[model samples]
Target: MRLAAALISCVLCVTGTVGGAWLSRPASVDYGSLLSKASDIYAVTDERGDATRLYVVNNASNAAISRIPGAAAELPWKVNVTYSLDGPNVEANEISGASGLVGIYIDVKPQSSAANHTIPVVTFTVPTQVTGDISADNTASVATQGSDIVVAAAGNVSSGLKFSCYMDAKK
Candidate 1:
């Protein structure tokens, strides 16, 4: 009788201990910030028929760098911009030179607010000219030397726009 009682007690103790351990396991956790980089900056314009305001922010800092007026005219259905290092060295007037190139592409939905009623593809080089109207995909390339920059905008009516620019490196 004593052995059977002891056996029952042992089983109960083991079951209780196992149950307690199983119930006390740690829960899963997710700990990390979504944005964490300087190159992660992006901007988007507000809706049309309203104020022409631009919203710019950096993901790393999660802060608004600037909110300038006239930055963008209308809300683009879709906007995509990319930059790349074109060449380590370039030829300038038969002379070897080095410069950095930055490209910007914008696609704006057709809207009626301004007089021209034409979507303008502006470049850093000739900020004055309208360049021309672009299709859904507009690409503009610019090369920078110090503060000066030269830009080219290619109009894409049937297809897409393709442009290029040149810059001179500081001596």
Candidate 2:
């Protein structure tokens, strides 16, 4: 009886330790590699020159869309989108109640051949209203599916929602 009890306790201790370690592990994301394949990415700006959208050159005529867009295409550059939910990089106050506003910043750099030019960073705000179609996971996630930069934040609402917006990489 004594030997059995000691063995059970030892097993329980090992199992608990392993479970705790696995549960407490911190998660990480590789932002740099996310948009590494994106090229000829442009920042769409309003009449005032404020970035309102992102456009990736595909087979369409980017120049005919509007000359007001950022110089990413003119400079023939690639872009990196740095995104956030609620922190220094995000506009935390704008995400109150039903307001689903997210702050997005894009870094535009010249191609490797034009390395001498300066890097341009454009900032903008996008509305990601919550909807029933989304699942409530209480966490934020982002990814580039084809030409779209999909941002889903399920923590804000009960049913959760997603913002399948940005980068009209029309083929």
Candidate 3:
């Protein structure tokens, strides 16, 4: 009788745990689109001084760019951005340089208004343009964390621009 009771208890515990986890899990995010949007939204390597507004544009051309088989925007620094399944936040890792270094990384995510308890809609507004040597791996990844999209980009200033920097965004 005790053995049967123990087995029943274990089964019930397992079932409840699984059910709870499933209910708590967030909806899946379309990481591919988010990654593409993130890449499309660009900021200066060191635009901390300027109050640059970062937002994603929803247009035919931008969507078409995302669908392109082999299309990627080149970044100035020798940094590589990739998608990953494991990351609570967008970040850069494995930063190194052989010929001296001054590296920087920028990550952007949804921020809710504290007073209003509402998320601000990020849309492309002003057209800001600056010129520099742009280069990238012509590659990206569609990684996610539950319903939130996350990216993992890591690189070193091995060649090209001496200073390395990277940026990320989500839609």
List RMSD in Å for every model shown: 29.9, 23.3, 23.9
The lDDT, on a scale of 0 to 1, for candidate 2 is 0.34
Candidate 1 global TM-score: 0.24
**Where is model 3 poorest over a 10-residue stretch in terms of lDDT?**
1-10
- Model 1 segments more than 4 A misplaced: 1-77, 86-117, 125-160, 166-168
TM-scores for every predicted model: 0.24, 0.19, 0.15
Residue-level lDDT tens digits of model 3 in 1-171:
111111100121111221121114459876676657553554333336663654455453635323333345322222223322123322334322111121232222222222122111111111112211122222212232244322222212221111223232211
For candidate 1, the 10 contiguous residues with the lowest summed lDDT are 1-10
**Model 1 residue 61 CA deviation in Å:** 49
Tell me the spans in candidate 2 whose CA falls farther than 4 Å from its real position.
1-75, 88-101, 114-171
Per-residue accuracy of model 2 over 56-93 as CA lDDT, tens digit each: 55444434544553454443344445444433344434
Model 1, residue pairs in steric clash? none
Q: Give each model's clash number.
A: 0, 0, 3
**Pick by TM-score: 2 or 3, better one:** 2
What tens digits encode model 1's per-residue C-alpha lDDT throughout 1-171? 111111100121111221121114458754223333234535453566454643333444555456566756443222344333354332333222323342233333323333122233434432212222212222443333244333434332223334433332222
Write down the worst ten-residue block by lDDT for model 2.
Answer: 1-10
Q: Rank the candidates by lDDT, best first.
A: 2, 1, 3
